[model samples]
Target: MSVPVLLVVEDDRALSAMLAELFEGEGYRVDTVYDGQQGMHRGLTGGYDAIIVDRGLPVMDGADLVALLRSKGVTTPALILTARGSVEDRVEGLDAGAQDYLLKPFEVPELLARVRALLRRIDNAATVVVAGPLRLDRVTRRVSGETPDRAEVELSEREAALLGTLMAAPKRVFSRAQLLASVFDGAESAGAVDLYVHYLRRKLGKQVIRTVHGTGYRFGME
Candidate 1:
């Protein structure tokens, strides 16, 4: 498997270098830029799996960089690198299209977790679809069977995995722990799982998935 590429934009040379080394060690191709101008140029023009941008930059601000990228229709998932840990700052980053916010002085594990989460969301949006009546193609991540409802649906790998597990035992509830083991792998979150379930409900429509209220979630037998 080819290493996923990440563009790290931070004016802090030491920090960027550290991130490059860390991510490179974990099977990722890291491209690091230390100035906002170069960061924007690389981030916008380069093909990257994800972007980690610092909010403060020289020559160009990080927010402006992201905003410009968005204007040009760049939709790559972005994670903001901010020293300000205030809620308002985090909100600002999110509003600027930053998917997740990481404060300074965080551990490497947390960064890896957030990166995995972002990638999961991307992969999820390209896999799974309802083909036709009594037909589903969660594998190969596309709709092939006839009579597809013309609705665009995608499930994250984790969601697809969990759904597959549940389908293996249709009409059975799998608790949170079960799903954490069989589904999340390492980037598991109950809220993320619930969010994906909500997405499936919208794709499948009319209560196809049921929540057991206390235990976890299950796919209803068709």
Candidate 2:
């Protein structure tokens, strides 16, 4: 399975380093930023599976960052970490679009558990992914074009995973290295990405994925 990618937005350098190490040790790919502005930039474009942010941050507050991300249609699950314990503070975080909240000085086990829970919720809700004319049923590993006459096509596990990764962030172009890491878990060489793209095009049509010359590939058929 592809490792989950997490973004940690904490101003405390020590805490951020600890979180990066913790999640990485748990087999997740982690990206850390020290302030809310950087958090917002990364969160908008990183295509992360989950984000952990501190409530008080330089440049922008975590709540505002979350709200802005939601406004931009970034549905990646977010958890707020803060020292504030007020019921109102928690409400504000939730209302601003965070899926979970973790208070500071929390037990490591509980934090990990909560993160897992958030991921589980997202996984449950993400059974179906629709991008343009394409619809993917992750459970069935089926890709179907929206046209009435287009028959659904079953994909091998790797092909399905690769397509799912591209479709997950339709606007983002992914490099071969990124695809290799995300879908193949770096078990396969980067050339494997090209091979699979050819396979998908043969099955789903040439328009299913677009190559961006030097950059990599992005979701096509829009």
Off by over 4 Å in 2: 123-222
Cα lDDT for residue 24, model 1? 90
Q: How many steric clashes between backbone atoms does each model show?
A: 2, 0
Q: Supply candidate 2's per-residue lDDT for 28.
A: 93
The digit string of per-residue lDDT tens for model 2 on 76-191 reads: 89999999999989987886668999999899999999889877764444467677889887779888875335898999988888887777656666788767755775698899
Candidate 1 local lDDT, 33-60, one digit each (tens): 8876687678758988898888888866
Residue 109 error for model 1, in Å?
A: 0.4
Q: Which ten residues in a row have the lowest lDDT in candidate 1?
A: 125-134
**lDDT of candidate 1 vs native?**
0.66
Instruction: Note the Cα lDDT for every prediction shown.
Output: 0.66, 0.83
